[model samples]
Target: MKNKELVENYYKDVFINGNVDKIPVYIAENYIQHNPQVEDGQAGFIKFFKNFIKTEPKIEIINVSCEGNMVYVFYKCSLPDGTINKVCDIYRVESNKIVEHWDVIESHVEKIKSVNHNSLF
Candidate 1:
């Protein structure tokens, strides 16, 4: 599969559909996570979500695109308390499997919390 398609399917199955079993299909066994909070490899990826999905937060995909083997996905994540977060995930696909991952996450800022000139979206 293409890099973009692989990432989109990953977000759909794992985050939107709440299907954790699809990890093996879309991700590589040696998956390396750049996020300091998560460990390396696919096992770490799955284990992290096992506890995280307990709140049943929903994922809203905004955009997905690719440049060569690198895929970029931007999405909105709704937390259990109704707070919204903006997320951008980047992945590198090799031999049709997602081998590397990186993510940036930011929570939506309320008007009262807006101390800067930047928009959250």
Candidate 2:
């Protein structure tokens, strides 16, 4: 698979399914996750995400784009309490594996309350 496809599938299988087995396959050994809550490497990334997914199972990816070594994705996560958050993630690929990642997250309180707010993610 191409780097973009690998990343998209990795998010689906791992984040949505709460699977950690795929991390070793899709993430580089020296992977660096830039999120403040996560440490360096895939292990830290997996641990952080495992906690996230367990608490927020209704995560969905809305869109993804790839350019050169970078992939950008937008997503929405519904917390167990019904609050929703919108998030954007950027991944840098090297040798067909994700080597670096960064993300931004914001709570979509108003959007979540509006029944007409169709999820973009």
Candidate 3:
């Protein structure tokens, strides 16, 4: 599969659906995570997602793009606790598997709280 497609599938299966069992199919065994909060490798990925899935955040993919082996995804997540977050996820694919990942997350501010009154999405 193409790099963009691979990463998108990974996000849908793991993040959107909370299906950790499919990790081996899309993630490399030695997956490198640049996010300081998460650990490296597939084991770490599984551990982190297992806990994250407990809340079952609703994920909406906004955009997806690819450059070389890198794929970038922009999305929004709404947690069950009423916290909304906008996230940009970057992934590096090798041999049809996601080998690396980095992400930036920002909490969405309500329109009433923003001076510009613009949506974060």
Candidate 4:
């Protein structure tokens, strides 16, 4: 599969659908996570998501871009409490498996609260 499709499917199945069993299909055994909250490797990934899914957050993908072995995905996550977070995730794929990940997450700001009056989505 293409890198973009691989990462998108990973997010859809794991993050959105809460399917942790499919992690091995897309993630490398030595997966590196740049996010400070999550540790390294597939074990850490499963551990983190196991807790994360309990929040029942919903995800909506905004955009995707791929170049070489890297795929970048921008999306919005709506927490059960009605708070929204905008996230940009970058994944590095090698040999058809995602080997590394980095991300930036920001709380969604209302247009009225913005000096530029622009939507974060």
Candidate with the greatest lDDT versus the true structure: 4
Least accurate 10 contiguous residues by lDDT in model 3: 108-117
Which parts of model 2 have CA positions greater than 4 angstroms off? Answer: 108-121
Compared with the true structure, what per-residue lDDT tens digits does model 1 show for residues 2-120? 77887887888888887889889988899999999998899999998888799788787778889999999888788778778888999999998999999998766332366688756
Number of the candidate with higher lDDT, 3 or 4: 4
lDDT of 4 at 65: 97
What lDDT would each prediction earn against the true structure? 0.84, 0.82, 0.88, 0.89
Per-candidate total of colliding backbone pairs: 0, 1, 0, 0
Rank order by lDDT, top first? 4, 3, 1, 2
Off by over 4 Å in 3: none
lDDT tens digits, residues 18-97, model 2? 78888888888889888888989878887777777768658777888999899998887887787777889899999889
Superposed Cα deviation of residue 74, candidate 3 (Å):
0.6
Give the Cα-based TM-score of candidate 1 against the true structure: 0.88
Per-residue C-alpha lDDT of model 4 across residues 30-110, encoded as one tens digit per residue: 999999999999999889988989989899999999999999999989887877888999999999999999998887532
Give lDDT for model 2: 0.82
**What lDDT does candidate 2 reach at residue 51?**
74
Better of 3 and 4 by TM-score: 4
In candidate 1, stretches whose alpha carbon ends up further than 4 angstroms from where it belongs are 108-119
TM-score for each model:
0.88, 0.85, 0.92, 0.93
What digit string (tens of lDDT, one per residue) describes model 3 on residues 1-121? 8888888888888888888899999989999999998999999988998888998789999999999999999998888778888899999889999899998888753323666756777
